[model samples]
Target chain A: MVVRKYFKIYLRFLSRNIQSSMEYKVDFLLGILANLFQSILGLIFIWAIFNRIPTIKGWNFHEVAFVYGFAIIPSGISELFLNNVWLIPTVYVNQGNLDRILTKPLNPLFHIIADGFEPHGFGFIIFGASLCVYSTLKLGLSFSFLNILYFMVMITSGTIIYFSINLFMATLSFWLMDIVSSMVLVHHLSEFAKYPLIIYHKAVQIILTWVIPYAFTSFFPAIFLLKKGALMLSFLTPAVAISVFLIAYSFWNFGLKRYQSSGS
Target chain B: MVLKSKIKKYLALSKINIQRALTYRISFLTSLLAALIQLFVMFYIWKAAFSEKITLAGFTYSDMLTYLFVSQGINNIYGWYTTVERNIAYKIRTGDIALDLVKPLRFNFARFFEVLGISFVQVFFIIIIFTVFKILVPEFRTPKSDLYLFLFLVSTFLGFLCMFSLSFLVGLMSFWTLNYWGLYYVKKSIFDFFSGAIIPLQFLPLSIQKIAVILPFKSIVFIPTLIYLGKFTIHESIFQILFQALWATALWISAVLMFKLAIRKVVIHGG
Candidate 1:
C-alpha cells in the first residue's frame, strides 16, 4: 500500500514537472534538441574511439556500443526518474530546501530523487533500444524465453547497482558538506566503465572488477547477454547488485545519523 | 572624448565583474582540478596505447600528450560563456535592456567588456594554477618554443571571438523564440567535439578532419595545438593565423549585423 502510494505520488510529481517545462515552449523544444545533440556526440565519441582501434581488449565497436547502449537505458531513465538526485544534495545544501523535504511524509531521499525528471531522457531509451536491436542482429544471437528472463533480471540488477553507487556518493554530503567534487570524481571513475575492463592493465582491471565493480554495471551485463562469460557469472549479477545495495544502504543510514542540516 | 569615456566605463565595469566572479573560489578550484584530472586521464590512455608497441594512428604517446596539453591551454583561453548574450536576451525579452541602455555607457560595449573582464580574471587564476601544476608535475608537456606559444595565444584569441559570435547569435535567437539555453547547448556540443576539447581531431577520419579544418571551431584548439607540436611549418602557422583572423573578423561582423536585426525585431514587453 505504501509502495503504491509512493508510485502514485511519483507519477503526479513527474506530470507536474512536465507541465511546468511545457509552459516554456522554447526551453522545452531547445532542451530536447540540446539533449539530442549531446547524445549524438556521445555516440560519435564511441564510434571514433572504436574506429581508431580495431578492437579494444577483444571487444569491437558494435560490442562496446552494445554495452554502452544497454547501460544508457537505465542511466538515462535514472536521469529522467531520479534527475533530482543529481541536483538535490547540492541545491538542498545551498538553498536549505532539505528542511521542506524532511518535513514531508515521504522518505526525503526518495522525494529528492524523484525531483527534476528530464522527460527528454526518453530519447536515450529509444537510441539504446535501437543499439540493442542492432547488436543482437549483428551477433546473430538466438533468444529463448530463458534468455529474455536473464536479460530482464540482469538489466534490473545493473540499474540497482548504478543507482546505489550514485546514492552512496551523494550520501557523503552528510559529512563532506560538499560532495560536488566527489561527484566529479565519481563521474570520472565511471567513465572508465564505458570500455571493457580488460583494456586496462591486469591490476587496473582487477580493481574495476573487484574493488569498484563498475564493470558489473555495463561490461558484466553485456557479457552475460552475449554469453561471453561463464553461465555462473551471469547468475552472479543479481547477487553482486544486492550486496552493493546493502553496503551502500548501510553507508546512507550511517550518514543520516550525522545529518546536520544546513539551516539556510 | 566620448570613445575614451566609453572605454573607461568598460574597464571599470569589467573590473567590478571580475572581482564578483573571483568570489566563486570553490568552483574555480574544482574546475581547475577537474581539468588536471582530465589531462592525467588522457595521458594514461595514451600511455596504455603506446605500451602495446603498435602505432594505431599517426600520433606517438608523447605527441598525443603534447596535443592534449595544448588543447587544455586553448580551452582555458576560450572558456567564456555567452553570459552577455543570454543575459541580454533575458534583459531584452523582459525590457531590462531599457535600464541597461539608459546607463552612461553603450549597452553592447558594456556587456562585452564586462564578460571579457570577468573571463580574463577567471582565466588568469586557472592559467596560473595550471602553469604551476604543469611545472611541478613531471608528466605535463610544455609547449616547445616561443613562436609556438605566440601562435597558441593568437589562435586562442580567435577562439574567444568565435565563441562570442556564437553566443551572440544564439542569444539573438531569443528575439524570435525567446529561448537561448537550447542554442547554447547545441553550440557547446559542437565546439566541444569539433574544437578538439574532449578528443583529438586527428583520431577522426580524414574527411572529418578536412571538414573540421574549415570550420572556425578547429581554430580554437586543434590549429593552435598543431602549431605548438611543431606539426605545422612556420608558413603553415602563418596560414592558420590568417585563417583565424579571417574567421574572427567574419564573426565580429556577423555579431554586429545580428544585433542590429535582433534589436529591430525585439518586442520588449515590460520590466
Candidate 2:
C-alpha cells in the first residue's frame, strides 16, 4: 500500500518535471545534443586508442566498448532519476534550503530523487544501449532469454550502486558543508572504471572493488555478458548494490537528523 | 605612461585572483586531487597499452608517459580555470553585463588577468608536484634539455593566450544566443579532441592530423608537450614558437572583433 502511494506521487512529480523541462524546448534539445556529442567524442578517443594498440591488458576493443556501455547505463540511470543529489553540497546545505525540504510531508530523500528527470540521460541510455548491441554483435555474442532477464536485473542493480555512491557523497555535505572537491575526486575515481578493472594496478583494483565497489557496477556486468560461462562472482553485484544503498540511505537519515541549517 | 598603468592594473587583477584561489579551501584542492586521479587513470591505461610493444605510434613507453604528464600538466595549468563562457552567459542572462560594461575596466582583459593569476598558482603547484614525482617515482621524466624546457615555457604562455582568446570568443556568443551552454559544451568536446589533450596528435590518422594542424587547438597542448620531449628539432621548436605567437595574436584579435560584433546585439533580459 505504501509503495503504491509513493509510486503515484513519484509519477506525478516526474510528469511535472518533464513538463517544465519541455517548456524550454531549445535548452532541452541543446542539453541532449551536448551530451550526445560528448559521448561520441569519448568514443572517438577510445577508437584512437584501439587504433594504436589492439588491446589493453586482455580486453579487446569490443570488450572495452562493452564495459564502457555498461558503465554508461548505470550512470545514465542515476543521472535520470536522482541527479539532484549532486547539488546537495553547493545548493541545499549551504543555502539552508534543507529546512524547506524538511517541511514536506514525504521523505526528503525520495522527494529529491523523484523530482529530477534529466532529458540528457536519454542520450546516454540510447547511445549506451546501441553501443552494447553493436559491440555484442561485433563480438558474435548472443544473450539467451534467461540471460536477457539477468541483464535487466543487473542493470538495475548497477544503477542502485551508482545511486548509493552519489547519495553517500551528497550526505557528506551535511557535515562538511561544501564537498564539491570531494565530489570531483570521487568522480575522477569512477572514471578509472571505464576500462577493464584488470588494467589498473592491484591497489586501484582493490579500492574500486572493495571501497567504492564501482567495478561491480561496470566491469562485473560486462564480464557476465562477455564470458557467458557465468563468473559466479558477478552475481555478487546485487548484494553489493543493496548493502551500499542501505549504508548510504542510513547515512542520509543520520545526516538529516544532525543537519544544522546555515540559518545565518 | 598610460601603457605602464594599464600593465600595472592587469597585474593587480592577476594578484587578486591568486589570493582568491584559496577562498573556498577544499574546492581548489580537491579539484587538483581530481586531476591527479585522472592522470593516474591515464598512467595505468597507457602502461597497459604498452605492455606488449616497445613503441606504438612513435612513442616509447617513457616517451608516452612523458607526453601524458606534460600534456595533462599543461592542461591542469591553464584549462577550465577560465570559466569565461559560463560567466559571460550568466551575466548576459541576468543583465549583469551592463554593470560590467559601465565599469572603467575592459572585462575581457580583467578576465584574462584573473585566469593568469590562477594559472600562476596552478603552475606553481604543478611544478612542485611534478618535481616530487620525478624524485620519488623513477618512471617520471623531465624535459630532455634545458633549452627545450625554456622553449616549452615560452610556448605554454602563448598557448595560454590562444586558449583564453578561443574561450572568450565562444563566451561572446552569449550576447546573441539564449542557450549559450550547448555551444560551449560542444566546443569543449571538440577542443579536447583537436587540442591533443586526450591523445597525442600523431596517434591520430593522417587525415585527422592534417585537419587538426590548421586549427589553433594543437598549439595549446600538442606543441609545448612535444617540445618538452625534444621531439622537434631546434629550428622546428623556433618555428613552433613563432606559430603559437601567430595563433595567439590572431585569436586575440578575432575575439576582440567578435566582442565588437556581439555587443551591438546585447539585449539583456529579466534582470
Candidate 3:
C-alpha cells in the first residue's frame, strides 16, 4: 500500500517535470538530440578504430558494438530515473538544501530520485535499444524465452549498479563537500565499459570487475549473451549488483546521519 | 606605455585566477587522475590493436602510444573548462554581465588571461606526471628534435586560442538563448570527434577526415599531437602550424563579432 502511494507521488512528480520541460519544447528536443549525437559519436569512435584493425583481443566490431550498446541502455535507464542522485553532493550537501528536503514528509531518498525526471534521457534509451536490437540481429543470435528473461534481469542489475556507484560517490559529499572531482574520475574510469573488457590489461580488467565492477554493467552481461567464456562470473552480475546497491544505500544513510547542514 | 600597463593588468588578473585555482586544487588533481586513467585505457586499447602487427593506419605502436599520450596531455593543458563556461552563462542569465560589460578591460581578453592562468598550472602538473610516466614506462617517446618540440609548443598555444574562442562563442550564445546546456553538449561532441581526441583523424573515413581538416576543432588537439609524434615532416609541421594560426585568428574574430551582436540582444529578464 505504501509502495503504491509512493508510486503515485512519483508519477505526479514525473508529470509535473514533463510539463515544465515541454514549456521549452525546442530546448527539450535539442537536449535529446544532443544526447543522441553523443551516443552515435561514441559508436563512431569504436567503428573508426575497428576500421583500422580487424579485431582487438579477438572481439570483432559487431561484438564490441553489442557491448557498447548494452552498456548504454542501462546507463540511460539510470540517467532517466536516478540522475538526481548525481546532484546530491552539490545540491544537498554542499548547498545545504538537504535541510529543506528533511522537512518534507516524503522520503528524502525517493524525493531526490524522482524529483528530476529528465525527458532528454529518452534519447539514450531510444538509441541504445535500437543499437542493441540491430546488433543482436546482425550477430544472428537466437534468443529463447530464458535468454530474453536473462537480458531483462541483466539490464535491471546494470542500472542498479550504475545508480549504486553514483550514490556512493554522492554520499561522500557529506564529508568531502567538493566531490565532483571524484565523480569525474569514476566517470572516466567507467568509459572503459564501452569496449570489450578483454582489451584492457588483466589488472584493469580485475579492477573493473571486482573493485569498480563496471565490467558487470556491460562486459560480463555481453559475454553471457554472446555465450563466450567466463560463465560463472557472468552469472554473478545480479548478485554483485544487489550487494553493491545495498552497500551504497547503507553508506548513503550513514552519510546522511553525519550531514550537518551548511546553514548558509 | 599603454601596452605595458595593459600587460600588467592582465598579469595581475592572471595571478588572481591562479590563486583561485589553487584554492580548488582538488578539482585539478581529480581531473589529472581522470586524464591518467584515459591514457592508460587508450594505451591498452592500442596495445591490443597492435598485438598482431607493428603498424596500422600508418601509426606504429610507439607512434600510437606517443600520440595518445600527447593528445591527452595537450587536452589537459587547454581543453574545456566547464566552470568558466557556466560562470559566463550564469552571469548572463542573471544579468550580472552588465557589471562585466562596464569594466575597462576587454571581456574576452580578460577571460582568456584567466583561463591561461589555470592552464599554466595544469601544464605544470601534467609535465611532472608525463615525466614520471616516461621514466616508468619505457615505451613512451618524446619529440624527435628540439625544433619539433618548439613547433609543437607554438601549435599548442594556437590550439589554446582556438579552444577559448570556441568556448567563448558558446558562452556568448546565452545572450540569445534561455538555456545553453544542450548546445554545450553538442559543441563538446563535435569538438571531441573532430579534434581527434578520441581517435586519430587518419583512422576516420576519408570524407570525415576532409571535414576535420577544414574545421577548427582539429587545430586544438590533432595538429599538436601529430607534430609531437613526428607524423609531419618539417615542411608539413610548418604548414600545420600556419593552418592552426589561421583558424585561431578566424575563430577569435568570429567570437568577438558574435559577442558584439549578442550584447545588443541581451535582455535582463529578471533581477
Candidate 1: residue B179 lDDT (0-100): 70
Record all residue pairs in model 2 with backbone atoms less than 3 Å apart, i.e. clashing: none
Measured over all alpha carbons after superposition, the RMSD of each candidate to the real structure, in angstroms, is 3.7, 2.1, 2.2
> Candidate 3 lDDT, tens digit per residue, A82-150?
889888989878888889899998889999888887777878889988888888888898768988899
Error of 3 at B21 (Å): 1.0
Real contacts recovered, all predictions: 0.41, 0.69, 0.71
Ranking by TM-score: 2, 3, 1
| Candidate number with the higher TM-score (1 or 3) | 3
User: lDDT (0-100) at residue B110 of candidate 1?
Assistant: 72
Candidate ranking (lDDT, best to worst): 3, 2, 1
User: What is the TM-score of candidate 2?
Assistant: 0.95
B56-103, model 3: which lDDT tens digit per residue? 889888888888888888877864443357568888878788888888
User: What interface RMSD do all candidates show, one decimal each?
Assistant: 3.5, 2.2, 2.1
Model 2 lDDT tens row, A1-264: 889999999999999999988887877777777777777776776788888778776678888888888788778887788788887887788887777888998888887778678887777787888888899899998868987888898889989988899889889998785676777678667787777888888998899999999888888877978983347668988999999999999999999999898895
lDDT of candidate 1 over A1-264, digit per residue (tens): 999999999889879988887888777777777766776676676677667776655666778778767767666666566666557468875566877887889887778876777766766677777887788888887677887777778767877777777778777777676777667666556556655555566876676667777777677777877767856665777898899889888987787767777782
The local lDDT score (0 to 100) that residue B185 gets in candidate 3 is: 77
Q: After superposition, how far is residue B163 of candidate 3 from its true place, in Å?
A: 1.7
